[model samples]
Target: MGARNKLKELRLPKRSEIERFVKQRPTCGMEMLSFLNCLKANQFQDSACVRERMALEECVREHQSSTGSGSGRKRKDTLMYHLKRLYYLQRR
Candidate 1:
């Protein structure tokens, strides 16, 4: 059986739950995106927000690098593409 099947059999949380967990963990995706959106809308003038955004981006970069599959560069590119789209949609 595939990894997904195994995970299902084990009653593991689905991908959405995992993503939600990742987002909710302190200093993670939701926080970063919130900070970025605030910055883009000129809601805050704090330089710390920029730093937070950069840190989040770095986390995502490292995650993509570490978990990337065959032809790592391709995986990274695909992840970036999806992330970019998600970020833009969140801003809207």
Candidate 2:
């Protein structure tokens, strides 16, 4: 079968099941595979994740533009430092 048809054939649990799963985990305990499977099975096409990421980028841009001085440069440097730290930690 085609990928699209296969995705449509998959079955996801009801909303209550999702709520129960979240309540039980309440942290980074949820399984990524399960979540992706659910999305694929349901053929969900919402771009909320992309939208939220874009919003965060816009906020950062605005902050940088408003503080066009040494402070703005410092803010970017700090962010880059933290991101590098996170990347290294993830690699380990």
Candidate 3:
């Protein structure tokens, strides 16, 4: 491999893009993207990529099997709901 290629670093996709994708589909693949993105943001260079990638994969698997957080859905009990309730206080 060329020296440049070896030196060439990998980066996570943009947060906005990742969020959009994850919102659409919160698959292991999507979580993988997020994990990698986080690794890059934390300044994890290529040397640690293999290790980090493995961790990413593990995280993806865990996320796929579980709904821990960040479900990417509009919450039902938002401020709008509360505001409406306040504006139209019904007699008990």
Against the hidden reference, what TM-scores do the models get?
0.33, 0.25, 0.27
Candidate closest to the true structure, highest TM-score: 1
Best-to-worst TM-score order: 1, 3, 2
Model 3 spans with C-alpha error above 4 angstroms: 1-48, 68-91
Better of 1 and 2 by lDDT: 1
lDDT of 1 by residue, 10-88 (tens): 4334456656655535436675777678687776775747767777777777666666632455432354456555555
Residue 14 error, candidate 2, Å: 0.2
Report model 1's TM-score to 2 decimal places: 0.33
lDDT of 3 by residue, 1-53 (tens): 56544334433445466556545454566557755776688796755567657
Q: Tens digit of lDDT per residue, candidate 2, span 3-46?
A: 65655555555546655654533322234344455556657643
The numbered model that scores best in lDDT is 1
- Clashing pairs counted in every model: 0, 0, 0
What TM-score should be assigned to candidate 2? Answer: 0.25
Error of 1 at 60 (Å): 1.2
Clashing pairs in 2: none
